[model samples]
Every structure is written in C-alpha cells, then in structure tokens.
Target: MASGDAGVLRQVQALFGVGTVVGMTDAELLGRFLTRHGDAAEVAFEAIVRRHGPMVLRVCRDVLGDPHAAEDACQATFLVLARKAGGIGGRERLGNWLYGVAYRTALKARAGAARRRRHEQKAAEMVPEAQAKERNRHDFAPVLHEEIGRLPERFRAPVVLCHLEGLSYAAAAGHLRVTEGTVRGRLARARVLLRDRLGRRGVAPAAGLGALASSRNALAVPAPLIEGTVRAAMQIVTGRVAPAGAVSAAVATLTQEVLRAMTMMRLKGITTGLLFIGGLVSGAGWLTHHALADRPEGQQEGQKAVPAVEVPDRDEGDRRVILGTWTTEIVIPRAVDGEPQPPLRLEETWVITGDRIVTAQDEEALKVGAVHESVYRYTLDPDVTPKAIDLTEPGWGTFPGIYELDGDQLRISYGVGERPTEFTHDDQRGPFLKTLKRVSPDPRPVTPLFATAPGGSWAIHPDDPGGATDKLTSTIGGVVLLTEDSPDGSLQVTLAHPVDPGAGPRPEYRAVAFDEDRRRYLLEPTLGGTGGSARGGVRVSLQRFRMDPEVLPEEEIAYLGVEIVTPGALLMEADRAFERAEAAGVEVLPPPRVGEPFEFALTTMDGEVVRSEDLRGKVVLIDCWASWCSPCMAKMPGLKALHERHDGGFEIVGVCFDKDAEKAKEAIESLGMTWPQVLVPDDEEVRRLWSEGSMIDGLPRLLVLDRRGVLRVDCAPEEVEEQVVRLLGEPGQPKP
Candidate 1:
C-alpha cells in the first residue's frame, strides 16, 4: 500500500537532505534518509516499506491467509520499526530487524485479537439481539485489529512481517531478531491458529485462507490477484466487512445505473418534436452564431454601441427545458497570440435519449481529449447552486451549461456559456461537482420507476426475480462471503466473491449502505461470527439539521486521528518539536481554544500548566514543531502576522511535543519567543495526545482556531495564504 500511493516516496524526497538524489544504493539511501529525515524516522523507514512492502505483505498472507488482515499487520509492523529506525544496525541487518519487528507486531496483534474476542464474548452475553447486531458490525474490524494483537508478541510479529508483508524468511527473521528457523516455526504456528479461527467460523480451508490472502496487495492489483481483486473486493466488502460484498457490488450498482442511463440516452431519438420544445437542448448544433456588427450591412461608420447583455442568475434554481438533441458544429477561431485555440463557441450535443436525459460530465474539465466515460447521479440542490454534472448512464455524460428559465421554454448554453460556475461538494467526492437545472421539461424522459415520492422516499416495490439485482448479496461457494446492511433498511444482504488468484484486485464493489431519507435504520456487521469494519463503505450522513449546512459543511472536518500509522501509533508520537514564532518579544495572548478529545493542555512548565481541557473559546495554535525543522522556525513571521492582526479570535501555542524536548527548549529560548509554550510530558498522556488530539504527520501544520476552538480550512495550504490573511484580518473590536 505504501509502495503504491507514492506518499512514502514523496515524504522521502521532501525529507531528503539538500542535493541528495534517490539513486543511491540501499545503504547510502538509508544512511542519508536517516540523517535527513532522522527525527522523522517514519519517512526514512518507508525505505523499508518500499523495499519490503510486497514481501512482508506476502508473508503475512501466507501466515494469516487473510490479505486484508495481513496488510493491517504489515502496516503495524512497519510503524513499530519506523519508531526505531535507528536501532537497525547496518544495511545488511535492516532486513533482519524488519522481520523481527514484523514478527513482534503480529504477535501483539494476535494478542489484541484474543482480548477483543473475550470482550466480544462477554458483551454478546449482556447485549440485546438487535443492539448486538449493530454492535457486531461496529466491532468487527477493531476486533480483527485486536485479534492480531492477541498473537504472542514473538510469533505474531514475524508472521505479519514475513507472510502478510511478503518478506523473505531470512529478512523477516532478521527483523524479528530471531533465527530464520524460528520465523518458519512461528509462521507454521500462525497458520495453525489461523486455521483454527477459520474452523470456528465455519469457513473451509480454501474459503478462509483465500478470503484473507486476497487482500494482501490492496493498493495495486498484482498480476495474480486480478481476478481475486474483482471477486474478493466484491466478497470481502459484503461478506465480512459489510453483508454482501461491497466494493464490486457498489461499482456494479453504479455500472447498472450507468447502463440504465445509456439506455435512456439512446431511446429519445432526435426528432422535430425536440425543436418544438424550444427550451430543450438539441444535439450538437452544426450552425454557427455569426457576430453581427452594430451597423447593419453598408450602414457605414460606427452607428451606435451595443448595450451589455445582462447574465441571468444560476442560483435561482430555474432550469431550461430541452427541445431535443442536435449536433451543433463548433469551429475554433484562429488564435491571435499563437497556435489555434479551441473555439469559445461550445456545442451541446443532445439526443432525445431513452427514459432519461443523458449528458456529459464536461469532457473539457480535464484535458479536452477523448472522454473517459464520465457519469454522475444528477440531482437538484435546493441549498446552493450546482456545477457540472455527469450522467450515471455509461455513455451519456452531462456537459456544463448556463441554463435560464425563459417562460415555458428554458434557454441555455452548454459550456461555460453566460454564467459563473456554481458551488460544489469538493472535499468528499472528487472535484467535478453536479447540480441539475430544472430545465424546460426534459425533451426526452421515459416513465420513471424509481422516482422519489413526496417527502423523498423510495417506495418499496416487489423484488424483480429475473430483473438482474445490481445490489449483490452473499452466495454460497464464494471464496469470500460477506453481508452488509442496505442503507434503505435493516434487511441484511449477502455477497459471495470467488477468487481467481490469477487476476489482481481493485475496489469494484462497496460494502456500504446508508439511509437516504434520514438516518433511520440501525445496522450491524459480522465476519466469521465476529465483527469488523468495511473500511469507508458505510458512510453515515446525519440529517440536514444535524449540522449547519452553510457554515459547517464548508468549515468542518472530522479530525482524521492521524491515519499515518495503524491504529497507527508513533505516527502521532510528538516527542519533541520547536516553533520560531512572531518577533522574539511579541505579546502572546491566551492559548488557542481546543475542543474535546484533546481536552488537556498538557502543561509541563512545572506548576504553570496549560491544558486544552481547561480552555475554551480562546484562540491558539498548538504547534507540534521541531527545532531542526527550518520551515517550522521560518513560519514564525506568518504565525506572528496572524497573531498580531487578529484581535483575539485566536492565539498560537507552541507545544514542543517532540521526542526530544530538551533540543526544542534550547531553540525556543534562543529564539526568545515571548509567548507561552508548553513542554509535553513523556508519559502516556503524550502518546494519548499524539493518538487522539493532533494529526501531526509533519511540522509547520497550521490549525486555524475559530472562536469555537474548531479547525477550519477553505483550501489546501499553498492556496490558503490569502484566506489565512483574511481570517486574520485587521484587528477588530476585542470581545470582552
């Protein structure tokens, strides 16, 4: 996983000492990696991830036989080593040490699993059945994490590093600080325990082992897991993760929706019936709009100037109706500056498609190249203006348009026409947004079968037996089987995915369900009679009123809890950090306000303590910076600029929460930061804070504090400088 995301590579490059190229041999690379990103041993350690991710993952799969589980262990194993990259003696021994860490992590994971099983057993006895089902769903993945924890430290570590991670026997053994022979024996034992787990869960040797083994290389589809990827992704999601396999199932459902859409696009064949409905969009218009000068032909001399045309509002929610489909020709004009540019005249190729209006998701969004079957579920947003939309129909994608209500007929331009772009949901779904204009009655629409009833409800209809059910459920003989709840109801659906080790894997299904009308249905999940997570398949959205759509949707972000590590530890371990802020003697106000979870200010300045739990509505920045971090110290002026400009909306608090506090203190003192700073304790509190409060993947991370002590950001860091300056506008009237 780390190997494919390019994150580790990016981090390594970013952390590399100036002038160091990545072409060095493993030894030279590790050495430089350690020297440069040493404190950030995690970055350096990724070298190991790149070097051994495949093998380590392979080893874990071989041992546990559950690819996903193996990956979990693999991630955990690397996390442990990252914290101790320094302990790795020489280049040659790196492999050995990695294996050792993997072994230990595996054992710990197994032990944790045992503890969870015990806990689950006790809870099952006490909880009611319905509640229990929900609890089971919620507890599955964590239980898996815990079971991995339960394995004896020694055996578990090697098993994960070797089998799940695909490390060679010798490499895993070296990393675990054990003999290769020991690794082999422990792997054998792990298999035994795994088989026992399978037997307890009523899975066959092939089914159980194959189920886990399939998830080993989740990021990229290795040649072998391709078929398994399709089926396993489908099965794991619905079976153990959800109910019916999720990934493939969801994708398939999406595909079916697309297919249905395409079918609709072709049905409403173009006819003069389309033009009769003037507002309706005809196919691509072959005609060109000749710009006529104000002076009529031969009326010589500039007779008069043309008045500016007023653009209509897009947020009014009015839409133009399509008359029919047309293929209008768009001729690009000659460029005055250089090469010929694509013509500004856009064309809307519409066809009276089947039962639904098929549209393009603006093939021009990216490079105006060949379209990549883009599709979207079109919907109208009563809250805000919507932007470009894609049709869920496979071939028919929606084009961006400026639509206006012109009496009964809707008039519109297909491309950026005459209006500005509308608002879109950018954070969650990829960038391209979708909003529908209530265009003149769609020139081409078929009788609807799934139209929402009054009050936004999909009335349940009889299940069509022969009608291919795109919503997949579990089936027997599947290499992997899972069941997930449908968002529409509590009804359980089963999914069975068979694995063909020859094919690689991809997330083609979704083991997710969510209630559309409201968050009504309670759901649960179970795998092998135990519970776990189906990753992000189940996205629970709250009722509209649960959050302020205007402010929060744009400003709120659920703290990711530092996803860098596994249940990732050490990732948040802010042992020691330094921050150079404001002029040395800048007046520092009270600490920035912090929300719950990271309640404590974690004061360590003897007696004079600052804890987040103790402050509210105060502005501050809890800087988890490093002394060696030039960027950390360099951002001082900006932090100062923000502090000085803002009346008291916020303050900046530098929490030298680095692994080495002494060094940080030296820098802070030398820099003469007049503002108050806290030294984090070296106890469980620090670890807890790392794990819970801040998502400290790197230094110079600025968390802007509002009066409510919440973090808000409108864009990425590089692009938000102006926003930050605005957020810290000229000093305002101070709040008493």
Candidate 2:
C-alpha cells in the first residue's frame, strides 16, 4: 500500500474504533447503523464502508474516468444505501446491491460531467494525450457494467461476490446460503453470459474481457476515499451536513435523484403488473362467456364447468365473494382479567380490490379528517375446515387468520403471531374477531364519513327529563349550533354559548356518525377525552325535528323545550343580534386556490406577530402540522434542512393545528424547528389561515407561496422542499 493510503487507514481505524465491528455481516452492520445512534452506529457504518468501499470506488472510477468525480459518486452511492438501509431486500448479498447502486450513481455522474464539459469552452484541451488514450482503452467498461447489471439477480450475485469482490467460491456460497457447487455453476454461467453480451457490443476478444474483469478485482480504493465516504454517510444519516462544499451538495443531489428514480421504477413495475392482471381477468371473463354460450342447453345444464373459470376453485370463489367494500364495528372487550373498563368500539371500513385490502377506521378519520389506511395483500385458503386467510404487508410480515362467509355478512378472526383455528375472541389472549357486512358489491374507495354528511346552522333546545313546563316564565334561551365542512372532509361543529356571544364559539365537537336512512346525526362533544363522550358519561344523539306548524308555530318553536332541531333552519326570534354575531364570528373561509393571496396575521409562541404582508418579499412555506401527527414529526428534519439551506431567501411559517400549544412547542423544540409558528387554536387568524390555506385533507400539509405572495403549491410535506426551491428561483416583487 502507498504511504498516504496507510496513514489514512490508521486515521480511520482510530476514529471509528473499527475493532468492535470486526466479523459482523452486512445485515448486522446495517441493523446497528439504523437502530443504534451516536458512536455505535458510526462504527458499524464505517466498518461497512471499509469492507465495500474498494469495489464501489472501482465501479465509479471505471465509469467516470475522473478520480474526483468517482469519489463523489462513490460517496453518493453509500448515502443512498444509508437512506434506504431499512427497505433494502436481500441483506446478505449487500455487495451485489451496492454494485448496482454504484454503477447507476456513476452513470448519472458521468452524464452530468458530460453536460458540464459541453458548457466548458476548454474542455477538450483540458485532458492530456496520455489520459485521453487511457479513457479510450477502457471504453468497454460501461458496456460490461450495464450487461452485469442486466443479468438476473441470482446469476449476478455470485459474479459480484466471486469476481468483483474476490471472495472464494466457498465464501460466496456461504454468504448466499447456497452450496459451493451451485455458486461455481452460477459463476460459470454468468461469465459465458457476460462474454456473449460484450461480443454483441463489438468487444470480440475474450482475453480483453477477462483482463477487464481481473483489473476490476485488482483495483485498490484509496483509504482517504473510504474515510470521506464513511464520514459523509454518517453526517448525512444524522442530517448534520448542510452541503459545506460542492462535492457534498453533489452527493446529496445524486442520492435524491437515484432514490427518486428507484421509486419511480418500482411504481412503474407495480402499475404494469396490475395492468397485466387486469387484462388477464378481462380476457378470462370474455372466454368464459363465449364458452358458456357455445355449449348446448342440455350440456350447459348437466356438465360441470372447468375449475379454473366459472367453477373457480374454493379460494377463487372466496376471493370473488370478498371483493367489495365492507363495513364493521369492532368491539374490544374492556374487561381485563375481570376488571371492568369501557369497551372500545371502532367503526372500520375495508375496501378489498383484487388481492389488496385497504382498511380505514372512523375514529382516526374524525380526529385527523383524512382517513389513515392500512394496506395489505391477502390470500385465502378455503380447503381448510374453517377457511383460512393470510394478510401480508411489506416490512410488517404476515398476519394469519380464519374467516367465515355467510352471504353479505363475513366474520374474520386473526392473530398477530399465530393462525387461529376457530372464530373466537379472548380479552387477554388469542384471536381478535371482526364481523363485517358488505356495503357495496363493487369495490369502492373508503372516504371520510363526515365528507358525506349535511352541514348548516340550527337552534337546539334541551329536552326536560321531568316533563314539566312553566308558560309564565320567559327567560329560557336556546343554543345556536353551526356545522361547517373542514377542508379535510371532517364536520366542524361549533356551539355558540348561550350567554357569552363576544368570546366567539370554539370548535368543541365533531360529527361522528350520520345515518342517512334514519336521517339522524350523532354529534360527539370533544371534552378532552377518548371518543369525545360528554360530561357524566352521557352520549348525546340528535334527530331531525318533525313537528306541524299548526300545533307549534314556527316562531314559538324556538320557545319549545324540545331537544331536536330542523337541519339548515336559521332561528328568527328576539335573539337575532346573538344569532347574527355568532354566524359572523365563526364564518368558514373558502378553500384556497393557486395564484391567490393567503393573508393572515398571528402571534408566534414567543409573542411576536407574523403576517403574510410582512413576509411578502420572500418565498414562504406554510407547514400545516400538529404534534400528534406522526408523519409531520417524521418530516421535521427535512424541513429543518430546507430552512438551513436557503438562509434568508426562504422562510417557513408553521401553522400548528394542535389543540395544546405547549405540546406543539415541545415538538418544535425537540425536532429543532426554528421557523415562526402560529398556533391555530390560540389565534383566530391562524385558525382561518389553516381552514382556508391548507388542502385540509390531512395533517402535515404544506403550502408554498412565491415571492409575489401568490399561493404556488399546496402539497404534502414530502414535496415541500422541491416546491420551495422552484419558488425561490423566481423574482421577488419590489418592496413597497
């Protein structure tokens, strides 16, 4: 080794404490890197870099033909690996995965370099004759890389382990969990495939191909490149690097590009597969129809259809029956070990389409406005005594269950770790049961229940339980209730206080259930408790009032002590001033649109006022987030990075929808959110801003306003940085 390489190796060994991670597998190292924090994670990640850096560097150098560019591409590949460590499949063959990543990153870097060279006037003159000739000699390197990448994984993995990484057949076999003979056979087959592919690309000499592969095996990656890559990976993982140099910025850019590309490719594959399956299903239906029509009447009546189509085997029949929208109310027994507790009942909607199931619960939907869906791919086995079902979610493993189908009504009993033999439920142990009723024969997407409910203003009167009335008394007043549709499809119900009109009615309740058939709406008052049960544990239910005007005059209706009120009827009585004040105070704003100005002035946690007018000259990102939003909290780091990246050119104004300001503040502090935040519940202007500006479909919504104060993009948190960058590139309006 060179003296510089030796010195750098010593430095890395000392800094990373590499001895502790010795003999660890790639998966073990990756697990430690992801699950552990601080020094422990750094050590594991550094060990990974030390183990695989040379091969990655070799791939980068062969593609880019520039040492500096190669180093950047190598670092970016590791960064991608770091970001995707948890989602990566086939951990034992990590080297093969890294080889593919390295090849792709290098190719991207090479294309970028070519673009830059085209823009540079002295680009051709910059390279010396010797270096030019050397680059030409390795012209076939890219073709070899492409062909190797194109090889089927099983064939490619052994070649990557044995030829590129220089592992023995036995070691490769052990890593792959296959026999040595199998590894040898795969490698031999891989070599023939590569040779044939390279020849088609006009590289005919077998000797030259062998020399290129051997050269890749012999190339030594500099220790400093390994150290830089390890340090960059560690910094990027912790979100500590703010692109201090061009290379650092390039690494971040390249990593995001590759990750985005990979995501798009995966989505494309899924879409194509789904389309193919749909075509197959359509074709099968057509063929089945023709086959049935072509048969004679007697044959059709007496002959049994083939098992594949009309007489679909047990599993397929079950699948056909289960495909559609189903509704269920799951009640978890509250008694734990004979101790009495409130039984929790959840209204869940499951939409089963093709082989996938999407479940949405009403409790979460009412709280967040957007229904959080849990998706799983399911398979049914009807041959069992009690029909069996297994649900599989990516990264979550499989959940086994047993099902019973009785026409429109279906019952499923599932367990976390084991398959239940019978449909039974136990409070403390064993299977949990859910009885579902098919709502629609055709599969339909589950939407928030409140989105489909009626909204307007009504006057409510308390029904006297004692059934006593005093006609002489005249001081009893009625309550005005206003129901509005929130941007996210939740019903926001506000009750105006009987005595206090200036204080403004707060959003204290949400419509939980709306029975269209019964024409009844169940309003659950949120009193800082689960299920929003009212005080003294009494749940309130409202029914539409149906009374004749002859018996009770419309004017005298407000005076009646009846509990029900007509939907969408405004009270016209002596308390007109109070009614008008309440309506004006809690008026719902229209949904915000692109190119429209979003105006708001609200106080921050530190008692400072922030207004849209004050932020006119800069690009603004309004993050509609809450403390309870897990997805919002997950995005804080990226938001912080964007804040740091733009310096003073961009600004983020947080519109926190959290009911408790302290919790929101605590989350901001813990997550290092240094932007100006406006608490929605604390300030009226901020509340209006949230209702109008946000798409309101979900928490963690992001709204971007350009320098001209025009609303540019209203998107999810993941798309914030891209939108902000796009806006920042535009010219700002002149200061008034």
Q: Pick the candidate with the highest lDDT.
A: 2
* Tens-digit per-residue lDDT, 1-736, candidate 1: 5433454355556555444344444455456545753223334444445665665554444444445655666654544343344444445445444544444344444444565678764452576897665444333333332334334333345555654555688866555445676567666755665565546555454554553454345343242222223233223223433234423343333323333432333242222122212111121111001001011112212222212222323433422233333233333353311224556543433332222333322323111211111112233322345332323222122334433333443333333222226433221111222223333333432212111111111112111110111121111111121222122212233322222222232111112222221121212223212123222221111111122212222011110000001111221122111111122222122222233223333444444666553444554455656677777787666656665666455556676656677786788777666556766556654444443334443555555444444555423334334655554453541232
| TM-scores, each model vs. reference | 0.25, 0.37
Candidate 1 wrong stretches, greater than 4 Å: 1-182, 190-607, 610-619, 628-630, 640-650, 694-698, 707-724, 730-736
Model 1 poorest ten-residue lDDT run: 286-295
Model 2: lDDT to the true structure? 0.59
lDDT values for all models: 0.37, 0.59
TM-score, cand. 1 vs. native: 0.25
lDDT of 2 by residue, 1-736 (tens): 9757765566566565634676788888888898988767877887788788888888888788788888888888888888778877658778888988898889888877787878978634567899887687568778777777765455677777887788888888878777676677667656766676678679765744665567546456666666666667777678844256524677778777777766665564445334433332222221111110111112221232211112233455777888878998755544311235686666888777766665656643222112223446688888897899987643234668999999999998876667888788752343668789999977774532222111111112211111111111111112223332222223334432221222232112222232212122334343322233433332222222223323332212211211212111111111232333345553222245677887656677788988888887788887878889899889989989989999787899887788887788789889888889877665655454334333253677777888777888878776888888877776645432
Clashes of 2: 1
